[model samples]
Target: MNPLTRFLSELQEVSLLIWRAFISIFSYPRYYAETIKQMDLIGVGSLPIVLLTGFFTGGVLVLQVFPTLQYYSIQNEAGNSVATSLIRELGPVLSALMVSGRIGAAISAELGSMVVSQQIDAMRALGTDPIRRLVLPRIFSLVVMLPLLTVACDILGLIGGGVVASSIYNQDYHVFATSVRVGISTSDLVSGLIKPLFFGLIIGAVACHKGLSTTGGTAGVGRSTTDAVVIASIWVIIFDFFLSKALQYLLDLGQL
Candidate 1:
């Protein structure tokens, strides 16, 4: 097939997946309940990793950039750059990637196991829709959890950056705070939050797709889980680039 046709066919599959989930959502209250459960599992359960990753990411980012700022005689602007980058990009994307490594793998493993064990078939036999009962909840949970997790990451990451800047670099905390306050805007924060929401959806959907397609047996579950994480991470990076570019363009256009 031509590349154009192949692309269109893949696009159609994605649209159909979204459409099926969208239509099924209206008829399924239980799916929402499962979403809440999954929120705790996917969100609350992943908090430690998220927190640890964010803290280190922020500290490292500040450390790496601090020397550049000092060399440029812009040491005073360290906090502004850190805060702007974290709130506008790093916080959400880093947190999402971290969570995807943890939660995404588990989600795929669980669902793939169900498929392998015929539990999904049992659900079908019982007149329950696996997509609604299983996949939808996960998708919804991810969408909700990722943004909240990003907020936590932003706060924690900024604090970590402040710690490193003040303690190690001898930058004053008050100066750092003021720079952050000046540099980071509500829109910047919101943009970070927005990107992660889509990131969450992609992670969950990709995980579900891999799980639902699992073959073989126990080994298949493991493979599918790994594949889910790999696919989700790649898609997250791709989406982040596009989202960043799109947002930057819109912001520039708006300024005009």
Candidate 2:
């Protein structure tokens, strides 16, 4: 198939997969146990990296913007820059990217291996819908855990900014905190918080689809894993752009 046609086909399959996963939520057996396991794997397993990444990202942002702010004689409002940047963009996007790299790759690899090994076929032979048994659990876990992870990233990023402010810039913590408080708004925070949900959905859907569609052999599993991470990460960024635009439009209309 032509590349464009192949892309459209892939999009249709993933969309249908997402729809089925959503519909499966209301079906019986609910797969609570599988979901809990996935949550632990995707959420808890990812916390350390998220925290570390968030902290460093905040510090770097503050440092990067300091010269510009200082040139404009607004050095005291460093926390304002950090707060808005982390809350509105960096925290959610970066966290989602990280999750896509880690969890996305893992999900695809696991499922792809299962597919290659005929385990998924066995499950289907037993009359269990793989969408309900596998995809839904992963989708549910990511949708629930990603926002929570983003919140943690936002909070840690702020703390990291404060540390940089006090240690490197010799600014007082109270001033930094006050600046962040005065500079941030409810709408900004809400928009940032809301982005991870869609990002999570995109990641889960892409990863699961790649895994389920794996062909060839172990080599195909590796390829699917890599594609899942790259595609999910790209989709998160693409969705983030649209989400940001939509949020800005809503804010302009005083709806958010």
Candidate with maximal TM-score: 2
lDDT of each: 0.85, 0.92
**In model 1, what is the error at residue 157, expressed in angstroms?**
0.9
Give the backbone clash total of model 1. 0
Which residue runs of candidate 1 sit more than 4 Å off their true CA positions?
1-14, 253-256
Q: Return model 1's CA RMSD, one decimal.
A: 2.4
Shift of residue 57 alpha carbon in model 1, Å:
1.2
Q: Write the per-residue lDDT of candidate 2 for residues 1-256, one digit (tens) a residue.
A: 9999999999999999999999988869788889999999989999999999899998998888877888998988899889888989999999999999999999999999999999999999999999999999999899999999988898899899889888988889999999999888988888987899899999999999999999999999999999999999988988888899998888652332
Q: How close is candidate 1 to the true structure, as a TM-score?
A: 0.92
Measured over all alpha carbons after superposition, the RMSD of each candidate to the real structure, in angstroms, is 2.4, 1.7
Q: Which ten residues in a row have the lowest lDDT in candidate 1?
A: 247-256
Model 1 per-residue lDDT tens digits across residues 76-116: 88878888888778888888898889888988999999999
Q: Candidate 2 regions off by >4 Å? A: 253-256
Query: On a 0 to 100 scale, what is the lDDT of residue 147 in model 2?
Result: 91
Q: How well does candidate 2 match the true structure in TM-score terms?
A: 0.97
